[model samples]
Target: MAEIKVEKKKPIWPWIIAGLIVLVILYFLFANGDDDEMIDETEQEQVIDTTSIEEENTANWDNNRNDTVGGVDGYLSYIGDESRMGIDHEYTNNAIIYLMNAVQAKANELNVNIDADIEEIRQKAEKITQDPMATNHADKIKDAGSDLTNVIENLQEEQFPDLSQDVQEVKSAVQDIDGSVLTLEQKDKVNKFFDEAGDVLNKMS
Candidate 1:
């Protein structure tokens, strides 16, 4: 028998060790992948939470319009467009109507009676602007704004006689004026009225 030079079987241990190394590398890769996915999910949740907080803050700001005189001032100020030409007859007329409406609403809230009729004032303002002979429609609107200021002042004095009533009524009236429009002068008057009224209300509280 030829001396069986049985080739020593290639060490099986080396092949087994290589296989084990490959499995270890694969395990580390899979673990790292899972960790990356978890990190991504956590970051996404944080972003969502931040967005929700921002939305809530915005909502709170809007809701403030219904609580205080300053809020009404903010609402009205936002609506008035200074860029709109006061010389435009139609625009002036519409501005007067809006002013009258805002005044009337505030008066009603305070349980004060305004002698002027809002609808009548609106109609008259419109007619004055439309008349070809009218040369001073803008001045007329300014006069209306003045009249509104007078009414607000009168209310601030007389309507707020009772602290409970004044506080309650003012609270009820504190709401968003979504579509209010005014001229620059009218806006100033409105802001002044609110300032005075707020002082009175604060005293009562």
Candidate 2:
């Protein structure tokens, strides 16, 4: 009998085919994943853009309206109801002037007596600037400072005299309110001033 002849089949070709198929599948999966990541990034960017647009729209809307302002009393001296010299209302202007004068007098007395008390008054006044009802009065209070400063300057120039005793008394009353200290007598005075100031403010509108 002739020796049996045998041949070994090559396995390399099958392995190469399987590797190529696996690489192709990996490539497709990686490419699809990259596309999904890009889509997510774009969505996030669009959301940020939409939020910015809404904020800008809200700001524009706010800018168009004449909103009621508070804490403008300091600058009230610079503008008037009719845009004339100082405030236009006679009663309101005079009452504010009176209040300012009183504050100045009290401030002077307290300055020599207890500077700490004056500081306390200032702190209280600053706090009042935050109140909803008091914000509108801030301008008036600030303007009062200007008015009193002007008077003091005039006195320094010898064009004005020192505040009178009545003015001093009035100032003491206001200082009590400004310092959040109220005696029975001071309380009565403060109530009167409040009533008068309310009338003046009501007339402004």
Candidate 3:
């Protein structure tokens, strides 16, 4: 009888178990990788949003600063309109009063300190406006002219070089108004000041 050699069959379970272990490990690694990617994406988005907010805040601040700086130009236009309207009619006193008010308001806005004499002159102009037929109307106008001159003189040329010249012209025109009437020449002179001041302010930026 020939002895039959029985071949030993290797168990397949070990191979199957090793393959399953590999699959589990792969699954866990892939899952952790996805989580890491999600975290990175979220962090990136947060950074982008934070940067946008910072940029928006900076733009808003610049806009506000520009508006404040440009306020004088708008006020000057308003004064010009009032002056033209008043000069064309019998409300010269009222025009002067409104003009001085504009000046005072602008001074306050710019944090400029008005001299006491200018304030007194402004008050007198206001009173004259309340009574157009006041006997001291001419005197009040002259005093306001003086005040304007003083204001122009006190202003630092280095700080307001562009404005000083126009303001000086305005003072000259105001001084030329000898009576309650606004002459056409004086009106033209005042308008010239407006034109020059507007040009200067527009060129600021």
RMSD of each: 13.9, 15.5, 17.0
Q: Give per-residue CA lDDT, model 3, range 153-189, as digits (tens).
A: 4543534666766556556655665555434435554
Error of 3 at 75 (Å): 4.1
lDDT of 2 by residue, 8-118 (tens): 877798899999999999999999999999999999999999998767645532432222222124223322332221222233333343333333343343342323433
Tens-place lDDT digits, model 1, residues 139-171: 554444444445554665665555544444333
In model 2, the worst 10-residue window by lDDT is: 63-72
- Estimated TM-score for each candidate: 0.37, 0.29, 0.42
> Could you tell me which 10 consecutive residues in candidate 3 have the lowest summed lDDT?
61-70
True-vs-predicted CA distance for residue 64, candidate 2, Å: 7.7
Comparing 1 with 3 on lDDT, the higher-scoring candidate is 3
* TM-score order of candidates, top first: 3, 1, 2
Q: Best candidate per TM-score, number?
A: 3
**Candidate 1 to native Cα RMSD, angstroms:** 13.9
Off by over 4 Å in 3: 1-77, 80-94, 115-118, 134-136, 156-158, 162-164, 180-205
Question: What is the TM-score of candidate 2?
Answer: 0.29
Which candidate tops lDDT? Answer: 3
